[model samples]
Target: MYLDYFPYPSLRLHQDRMLDAVYDTVSSGDHGIIMIDAPTGTGKTSSISAALAARPGKIVVAVRTVSQIDIYIDEISRIWSKTRHKPEIAYMVGKQKICPLEREFRGESVYAGCARLREWSRNYVSSRIAKGSSSIYDPASDSMPEEEPGYRTFCPHYLKSREGFELNGAVHFRRSGRALDVVESLKKRPISPSQLAESCQGICPYEIMSLYAKDADIVIMNYSHLFSPDFQDIIFQWLEMDSEKVTLIIDEAHNLGDAVRDMNSRILSMRMIDLAETEVEKFEGTLGQARLDESRERASWRREGIRIIRLLLPRLKKFLESKQQRMAEGEALLDADLFRSFIYADLDDIEEALSNFSDVAVAVADLNLAEGDRENLQGEIQPSLALVLLFLNDIERAEKDDSYQSKIAVSGSGGKRQARLEVNNIDPAANIRRITDNINATIMLSGTFSPLEAYELYLLGVENRAKKLSLPNPFPRENRLILGTRKATTQLEVREDADNREEISGHIRSLIE
Candidate 1:
């Protein structure tokens, strides 16, 4: 079956082994995490496809982003065009990103030559949707693309025990054959809001991952989605159920730790707290008798959170300044940029102060979730908290690292308003272990897992049942060259002189050319 679908001549020995390993791990029913270190040009995608063919349960292949997902999906469709077995693939992206223009294109409504209008359609849609304007939406309802009348594209591939899990390609809607201009299309075939939505099946990364990805073969999302608490519930759910049975690939593994750090951190900012107060004020006149008092209390708490941070930041800044002055005289003992190296030192305290403010702001914003702002609160608070907490936690933890000891400080009095310094050494082992205990298997793969042994040790925290393999670069070595240069090397030092500097510059330019 693979022979017929695969356009390539044959799978290499290592590719076959990788495929078999993945299949065998799934068959064992004990989640397996295999890190295949196949370098670029080694038919990595082909090997992955073959593995999917072997055990086609509800597949969820995640790329780092939606665009990459589109590229891979298109490539797969083109490759599988002649095959008898083809998987039903769906594309999901963020709701914010799926502009109205793109929806029109998918629906085959936006006329050609008006590319500019197509681009702006998303902004139009956002505005209309925000305003609850039904007039503009009415046109979409009038024109509904009829479902295709043909035998659905069905994949012959099947897992041994999964009888009902069939890849039904017909579930997806194809765009219309006709492309019409805005005026003509609107005249001939008005589309309804429901039809527009149906034709536009795009959902955001979180939406796809959390709600729409039940039986998805591939889920395209950001790195943050996998590690962040906002999305960790879903990530854990997937891992806990069949993680060992899954192939969890981190496309950009270099940023994985940073992403994890980002996911873990939280911030509380003055602006955020202020925004909450503003939003809560807007709801003052509309809330119900039942929830009015609770809403008011929440608003007050948000205000209190903001006040605490505002008072804390000025003191934190003065402390850091004093430390900086004291340290300036001790250059032999410490590098000038030692404190400035970490986030806490570099981000003028205002930034960290604002970031921390954002954290409390999130809680404050949540308080504004009165009966009037219910919908806004429902959709916004979680993401806001997720975003703010990441910064807050990062700032607090980064502050704790003894390497940046000069940056640490404490101010403000006790009683729900004290400012205490928080620090983090970020134990990769402990963190990885926590994730591993939650999932079946953890695979950390990247092109440059520098100090590969170090990475292996790091993964040891989560990858107790995993096997690691490294492959050489698949490209010709001669094609890739490495060169190193330093800013202060080779060239003669040019003093801020009149004649000698110009002569040196000309010589450097000649050498460059």
Candidate 2:
């Protein structure tokens, strides 16, 4: 994994050492994560990236968010300028950030929109051709105009993927000829979400980049992609990446633990139940007896699901509302049978009913149908169903697994004392292992790994399977300075106090001055 074709003329003293450490460990044919900690600006990106690039397989760069994209873009561009091996690079974000059909786009409705676009973009040109042949234009006798459809004229990004560039009178990516003609067209694919939105109209960023990632040498994405089961399935099943051979380069390594926790963390609230109950009431009130009788069975699952939840609520609320004082601690467990039954008997039906309800909700919102029944289906029902489903799934797991601890924490009471039931994986190691089990190796780099032992034991589950490297700060004596201050009480309560806040503000001003 040593860098044979790095663009940089020289690496910093610490960077050089890190580069070698990475190369040695990876080249040793190790099978586990390699953790490295160095102060910021140690050239960690260049060193690790160059090392990974030197190897044969694709480099998967995972960051915490889209805001930090330039790190990879700048590093790769700088490196690519100097190497003949211009690795195909691609990045992806959730559909709300990339899709155009939704109100705010992004992947807000990705589960619905993405499926539509993938099928739409593929058949767009054929649909156009078939439409044109029978109407305004002749198919067999006349050559079709460059854009027979008006949408293609205004939406070039849509057309680029729909109708592949014709090189030598044949479609480029369709039949595989000279890729030269469509190189510029392919470059239009955005590297980030903002760029994607500004790229063009009618273009699905997630769909386009997914295609690019399928053949890419390095696929850059948020750390979230790995944390989500849906995205994990997409990685192996949709993107067709060979999980056993693909290497993982997880940046902001310290945050992975928290990210995993946040990803797995779920809360099903009383407010959701209230909203769901309101929606059901609205459906019944608006539809009336005649219409309700006609379509009641269609949404029978929804009412049954809600009824089951109603049965469990009072019992759950009482248990959660019990004597407890920990701010956000997992204090105790509840009856998992209630959650498990919901999962097995009602979860799937609830999901389908929620989806069916959403279409009706949208119809009501748009005033396309049932104008009198404007509130027939409330928008909150689907999300409520989703949260409830996730909550029940966690509960089901808690019943079966010893590692997971289920708790009911305070979510603020309204009428009859509200609570939030949650299942937290006490040790994230097992879950983290499942994430990387298919991968060949994982490399994690962070500016600080202060509590390395805890991270290894709790987060990675790789205390024995991973290698570690901790280097001293390399800044020179004059370049860095450490300052000390005493008599400052910035504890939580003190910060909340006005007098303490003023004192802290004065100290900060003095320090700055």
Candidate 3:
């Protein structure tokens, strides 16, 4: 196979084994995990593709990012171009993640794309306006400018073509133009599509994996899709394909824990709760018309719940703030597991109050109120309340299911904090054993299943244990020196040093010189 299509030159032994294991599992009618623990520089992609030749149904080689996807696609296309066995390949990502221009040009809804483009354009225009530039309002309606339109204004096909597109026909240039020109134009006008795809909910990165998990021979996607409870359900649905036919290969496995945590966590900031309260309060004073008798006690409960949320928000903020401080000072005061507990606790409290508030809000909505009081409603509060209720419901479902675990946490830096969660309660060992019991044969491989024993530790309790094998690096060992550095700067210290502008500048100068 012409594997040189890979951006990297050669495949590593572990990658080869993983690919071989994929084929072996399919042939033997069993499923297994291939733990690839290799440092960077191993040609994992080449090895995976090479091994897939033995047994191929629908092949999906999932990776973390689109760039990685691109590299894989390019390599696969090149190899399949020369090989006899070629599977149909299609690339899909989340609707929001893909370029709006591509979506619209491809006949997908411009609503999301347009919304995003408009938001971007608004920011750009607002920024320009702040800098005292009104030229943003001025457009060259007479002719297409030599300069390409901004991404928000540009059409997907135009951007993809790289030769740029024109504002064809009679284009109405807005005095205070919306950010997304394509969306704005489509709003006032319409375009004829060259062709149409099957339903256009406009797939996103995660949705594609969910939709095609079972049918696609070589599935490609993020680790989050397979490991996260919220996402994994979608993947697991597809993994039901005879158990033995599917292989889960995680790239950048080091980040798997963080990804899982993110998929499981939920964060409803104090601002969100405050906004909900403000909106819900619009129904106040009109309780006479509200159908539910607003007893002093019920009103008190609603008021108290709002108060509790207000009080609770500050604590959550304080907790997050303290963690931020500790992080800034370069300390390990918090971890993924601990932060998860905090989120769960906060959600529990929020759910209690929010549910009470929602009941009150619904009661108020049921009551006849003045148009002004009703109009005082905020847009996001109702949805926020509903979303919180939905999350709580999902939590309850997982709690009883016995198949999933819920892990939530507060994580990240000062300005960039994240509330995260991950659910994976099902024992992988039992999972493997059950599948093996059904299928009766298995093989696991990877170029980076290093130290070999580590994989054993990971898959120790797994059922129908397969024979273990270790291959050389498949390249000259002397040609590469594996340097283990002990003095690597800690993540916290690096973050701190990065915050100091002068020090960063000095470091840059030293490096440049």
Candidate 4:
């Protein structure tokens, strides 16, 4: 059915199977999870795109990295070109990656500096709109540049796009009096990030791309776009769209568990504590803080910061001094059962301590929000504090879920190190449900998503309504050589042993020869 729209010369057996799965899922109008295993060399990308092109509603291909976005943009361009009906396509990336205003601050941290600039831009635009100035973009305004002959001069989507993309056809540019369709040109030949950044001279590329994605036929984005809450407000909402139809393709899904964990994992360190203390000391002595009365809400947070520094910190410091080993030598795990034996007794007290430290982290972070220090927050303090808070919150939340296991570890020099807590969601399947639950059709694709049992149970949350599909190698294997030899073990401990290492090295040498 998709032959004309499918751009590939010929589909391999596995590729055809993938295409069928995607088409069938869409055809059945199913609303459940699908674990799709498509190994390399199967032309999986083309098959999936061609299949999805025929599906109704928006398609959000959530990939792992910016580089993956590049691949899809190219592939989507190739496959979509085959179809008589072209779908609007866009890629979503972080402002740090796409921000246009960040160019001026080349040497400094662009993301950190752009925060204020973005805020300023929003205010600038809003204020102009309020004053009814001509600078304010008016989509309905018939005022437009010269129209190109072939391109649609007036696409409804162009109105929402402030960058003059909503034109009689895609926004046209004149090169020596000849009108050129920018959007059509883009579909014909996709540009790299640098080129796109250059083309987006004035308008915020992030906003422009997001506007395009909000109405696009396909939106390719990073994993964080779905998993990170911050992106929900900015990017994911545009991608995780709903209609009578929806399909979410998690590419490179072999690392789904890791990606989820990375999204959920939080860590705190002694460095944060040190920074908190130093910031508190400096903040308390600052003239601005001194002028503020005790009635100020910030003063209370400042007191909490001081309390963490004066009281909570000493306990950690003492414990570090007591322990002979910390993260430097490796790590020492604190037993869960011994929770009471630690300095903090009841769970309430632990929560309170963690909460206080979290407050201190907040105070320190807010203190850095000062004009001079805002940019450094991203480059320095915020990361450590963010991890620390994530760690604490993870422990707190895991306490409520039996599926989670929490262990505390101590790292760094005893002189002034904080404890590191690691919380592993033993069953991330349950947590992953929250992310995939709403989608009508969820496609989890990976090269190594085998042992379908584990994947269905652990990755897909093993829903009764879910469909697990595994495709066979499409290519003939008669000419392929599958070689294996058991010689020396490469297990961690054994591999470190001198005799085992020598034996493994010998086997490697023999294999190479």
Candidate with top TM-score is: 4
Model 3 score (lDDT): 0.42
Question: How much does candidate 3 score in TM-score?
Answer: 0.48
lDDT of 2 by residue, 1-513 (tens): 345446677767677777776676555444557788878768778754544654446668888767567677767666567655455677866555565544522433434333333334435444554555332221223333454332232223343434333345332334112222333355533244465554433344544666666777778887767775435555565567777667778887887887777666665556544544554455556657675455676866544544555554444444444523343443456557654454345345645544544444443334322212101111111334334445656676776887677776654444333456677766666767776666767778888776667677767765666777776777876887676557557453455688777877887798789
What's the ranking of the predictions by TM-score, best on top? 4, 2, 1, 3
**Model 1, runs deviating above 4 Å:** 1-7, 54-56, 65-67, 101-212, 235-246, 279-425, 428-444, 459-465, 475-513
Q: lDDT per residue, candidate 3, 1-513, as tens digits?
A: 324223344455466555554456545544434444444455555544544554434444545555556665555565556555454444445434543344343332333344344334444444433454233323222232243444336222222111112134222223222223222222221111111121222222222233333444555666444444434444444444443445444454434434444544444444544444554455444433352345776567766555554444455455556554444333232243454365445455645765664565455434421111101101011234433444445555556665445543456676676543333343343333343344323333344466656555444454325545455555576776544434334342363465455555655586569
Better of 1 and 2 by TM-score: 2
| TM of each candidate vs. truth | 0.52, 0.65, 0.48, 0.67
Clashes of 3: 32
Give the 10-residue window scoring lowest on summed lDDT in candidate 1: 154-163
Q: Assess the local accuracy of residue 366 in candidate 2 as a C-alpha lDDT between 0 and 100.
A: 40
Error of 2 at 332 (Å): 6.4
Clash totals for all models, in order? 38, 8, 32, 14
lDDT of 4 at 351: 61
TM-score of structure candidate 2: 0.65
Question: In order, what lDDT does every prediction score?
Answer: 0.42, 0.56, 0.42, 0.57
